[model samples]
Target chain A: MARKAGSDGSKTAEAIRAAGLRLIFEHGYEGMSLRDLAQIVGIQPGSLYNHITTKQALLFDFLVEHMTRLTEALDAALAGIESPLARLDTFIEFHLRYHLTRRMEVFVNNSELRSLEPQNRAVVTGLRRDYERRLEQILAEGTRSGALNVPDVTIATFAIIAQLTGVVGWYDPKGRLGEDEIIAIHRQLVVGGLLPIP
Target chain B: MARKAGSDGSKTAEAIRAAGLRLIFEHGYEGMSLRDLAQIVGIQPGSLYNHITTKQALLFDFLVEHMTRLTEALDAALAGIESPLARLDTFIEFHLRYHLTRRMEVFVNNSELRSLEPQNRAVVTGLRRDYERRLEQILAEGTRSGALNVPDVTIATFAIIAQLTGVVGWYDPKGRLGEDEIIAIHRQLVVGGLLPIP
Candidate 1:
């Protein structure tokens, strides 16, 4: 649904997206209802059609927007970082910091893949692969330059991404450890893991 | 509900649990319905009550059973292993292998915690803490012995477990890499991550 920028329609669309993310995060995608979503967004139940075509579309939008922003932000973070090792350090910090504050989006993204329709799933999966490739390229370049000892680039990519994203599961903004401290610990683990053993 | 050992009633109860796991896995806890569960189990809709008390109870049971089996298996795997490094290695291998086959249970366990009642959530959380503590203790021991250069036992433990458990997310039993190869790659990532830098 297209709407004029800054108009009430666009504002309502944004509100719907935000509420959809929260509902999908708390209840799995299959469990979120349009009625409840409309209620939460303070719209009549039938009026949700003005913003989203379907619940499936809402989920797809969330995932696509998330992956797109993630990759774009990562690119911005790594620009002009020439060396593979330095770029890798930057990637780790960027990923950890980005994911730390977006726990709900991350949770919904990971857990809702099964709920996506096949074609939509493919699009989201492709976006995810694109994201993964960013890390894999970093690891592969590091391996080639003799700056890192990643035995298998693909496995290392998945392993490192998983390890970094896992921070969201336990990270608390108010927790004892600050964000920098958490990132520092993970940097040591990930970068330290890939460094060739002397 | 109590039944005689090896009775048909017990067999039916087992079937109900298995079917419940698959249903809750495919559909989230809230999405799963008793009617569908009964149909899947080949019982009349009303007959589901004979075996399971409520959908919430069934979910609670699945989680409790999964956690109980997981901790027991971990204890068995770690038995007679003395060295902290060896125990950590054993843990990586054990966790990888155990989670590899029980993908559904792990998915439901990780994703459906919100659906669990507060008291049930507390029990499951405690079980999870106990399991995490097992690894934390191993890291602490290795750290104290100067064998492992873990800066923080708790953070290291969470990172390693997340890295290992992630195998289940992408593991294909018939995929190119065999189980041993997967375990070896992860062992390198995890153990290499913790060793004191030269």
Candidate 2:
């Protein structure tokens, strides 16, 4: 249902989504309860329906929204980047910065895939495959132009994505390494991995 | 307490561990219950205490046991490997093969780390650090000897581990690629990433 303009419904809906993401990130989707979620959002249990109809819908929305934002952001980052190697560099930088700042989304997206029901799971998986395909196309382009020497484009795609996204698992903003330093390290690891060996 | 030799108690203990792993893998640590675990094992809830004292203890044991066994296995894998490059190759092969066959362990190890109690979490985290140090040392030695050229060994260590351990998330036993092919892909990505560029 659509919320009327100037109504509190839109704000409440956004609050519900933020609360749901935090709860699912801290506790798995299976472990979070509607009662706790409503409490966190400062609403009555029954009133939760005004924002989210069901817990399953909340989870599906969370995953779909995350994947949608990721793909759109990537497309924005890759815009006007013509060289395949340069496109790959943009991907590595974009993934690390995006994931590091959005740890909740990254954790929930990766860990809660199993909690999604089969139908919901299929949709989320399809979105993820589309994201992977973007990187695979870049790798294929690089291989064709002799700019990269990946033994297999598909494996390289998965490995590079994994390596880049891993920053979320251990990155600390106050830690020794600065953002640029971490990004540069991963850039070298990824770009160097794809370079033609002499 | 120790079970009597040759008694069903030993078998029951093994069964409890196996059942616990499955339940925790399907449901988060917080989402699983001793009552359900007992029901799955075909035993009374009270009898679960005979195998595991409490759920917290069970979670701790699960994580600690997983980390402990992983370190021991790594030690065995790297024994008597003298060359830094060869040792790095052994690390890649060992990590990929080990994680691929133990998808449940990898999932629980990565996902349920948040569920571990503070003291238990520290112990498990320390064990993991020790394991990472094995690779860090190998990388440092290679850099000192001018055989490897990692920009930052610490970041490289985390990135490489995450890249290698990620195989468990998507690998399929009946898929097009066999185990050897998967290993070669990762080995090339890692070793090629580290080799000095001429």
Candidate 3:
């Protein structure tokens, strides 16, 4: 609510959120302290409250922003796509890349999410569901249009996501295989199996 | 190490470890105390100390025993299977059942293993790695035998595991689908995708 320093406030908030995210990922939410975040941000602990009401608030913000980015990105990826097969490919590729670029942040959303209080958890979980819905829609469209063969769209959506998101656990920037290479293999596994038999 | 009760210390140790597993699964290790575990087994906390030195040690024991069960189950599932393709299906089914039975315990292993001390973490992680190596073995066998088709066995192994293991998050015993149906779907996803096209 403070919203001080115009653009400076915006920049500082992002910086603080990044630091908080790292601490939370390394040490569970209960383990991270506001003082640790403020010290990392090089600001008075009181000044931190100006940007976020509490540490939990910052966590919620990270989750919301993370989910929002995913929605917008997926929407952008699927824009004006007509072919069901193409839509499915875009869905897998977008999900994989979104996770790769936002590894730590996305991992937190996927793993530490249950730690949030009920109210905050609902908001975060709702947003994640929204993202999952996109995949469900793609699968539904693909099946209806005969572009794919899947038994259950609901199960397929979770399977695809869990398969793609595993990248965060093992994907290393220094690794020999690039992100695109990994994404390519993922696309092959999903689309190759899901695409209708010729 | 704790032994049995009733003149046999080994049995007593095993009972304590079993009680500890159920308690820790219901409540995260951090949330459960030695006292809670002892009470569940109808013993005093000091009695627990005679069996296991500390809560941390108890956690390590549960983890070791649980992981061993997982590995042995998976390994047995693949036994005497000559075809890498059939072996892969057995492997996936094993995971589906394992997650369903020990749902909470699996959740904790994936989520709370990082909370363990360095030494404990190493041992638990090694057990997990042994399970992971089984995944790699399936992929390697299939590729070497020219039975299954995939871009890279490495990515395929990780992708398949993530998709299969992710079931613990959403699977409900009261759900419409039965265990056999769910396992069938996993077989389709893994076998359908990996086996060479007809």
Candidate 4:
């Protein structure tokens, strides 16, 4: 269990989390040692428990917080959009922007899924399923409205999400394409894929 | 460097590679130890030298073999298809079918790239880039022939590949969707995504 970061411990807790994310990102969860984490956090090994209880707890905290924030932010983004098509468009844009700068988070989430304890894994998986279900709902609604040309809403939902999330793998802000251009390109691909065939 | 497996050593070498793959897939390349690998393969730790010199070499071999087979299989699959649209369809089917049953390969290839040594990483990345370029070539040719409406050939190629490769994450043989139906759903998504607006 994570001790809630109170006023004095908040900064230290945040710093610890950041370092944990970096270590786990570079080294697999099993490869990252608590001693290394404590050193990186500028804390004595024994004092590390002032924030996170165990390494597993730290990982669980990172994953749960990541998913929780992601889900909430997405909900907030889709709040006022009524039309399924509009929501779908918002989804593509929102998902891309959210993940564009969070490469470490994306890598850890995808790669270290095997490292999470079973109970923690279930919690994270549930949150992930919630996120997927959000997209599934949008696709289902879009299909119901005859505004989307999905042959199978579930498959399309997974395909589109996978396509969008993959941008984190190779996208570079310093490289050829700007964010808008990239987003526009994906918008066309995703929307075009979903639009009814003429 | 990996020794050329002679007739007597070939079986042991193959077994080592198999165990190496499983260890890296389960524990990550960084997390897996050569001692543990030897134990799993039922060989003395010193005997590992008969097959591979170092853990790095084993990882390099795994990645290189995976990408080499992928690229060659893709080339073979696309060899006779003259039409770009037909080729694109074949590429999607080939990639999906090749990866669908090889979930461990897909997971390790994507997750363990960071664990490869710098020069080795470059070699694997180069092979992967060659593969990506093949798709880029298909998209470029398709766009040039007016058979596709891809806004950006490079972006579409990545997007489609990502979309198709994502199937391995959730696809199960006993699942409701069969191969043909799953293939059709993806073909519609990838082909429709590339097709010009009506």
Best by lDDT: 1
* Native contacts matched by each model: 0.60, 0.60, 0.43, 0.68
Which has the better lDDT: candidate 1, or candidate 2?
1
Model 2 CA deviation exceeding 4 Å by range: A1-4, B1-6
lDDT of 4 by residue, B39-133 (tens): 98898999999889999899888889999999999999999888889989899899889988998899999988888878989999999999999
Per-candidate RMSD, Å: 2.9, 2.8, 3.9, 3.7
TM-score, every prediction: 0.97, 0.97, 0.87, 0.96
CAPRI tier of model 1: medium
- Tens-place lDDT per residue, model 2, B1-198, is 996887788788888999999999998888888899999888999999988988888878988888888889999999999889999999999999889989998888988889888888888899899999999999999999999999999999999999998888789999989989999988888888888878
Rank order (by DockQ, best first):
4, 1, 2, 3
- Quote model 3's TM-score: 0.87
List ranges where model 3 is wrong by over 4 Å. A1-4, B1-48
Q: Point out the higher-scoring one by lDDT: 1 or 4.
A: 1
Please list the residue runs of candidate 1 whose C-alpha ends up more than 4 Å from where it truly belongs after superposition: A1-6, B1-6
lDDT of 4 by residue, A34-65 (tens): 89989988899998998889999999999999
The local distance difference test score of each candidate is 0.91, 0.90, 0.81, 0.90
RMSD of 1: 2.9
- Cα TM-score of candidate 1: 0.97
| lDDT tens per residue, model 1, B92-145 | 999999998888988898899999999999999999999999999999999999
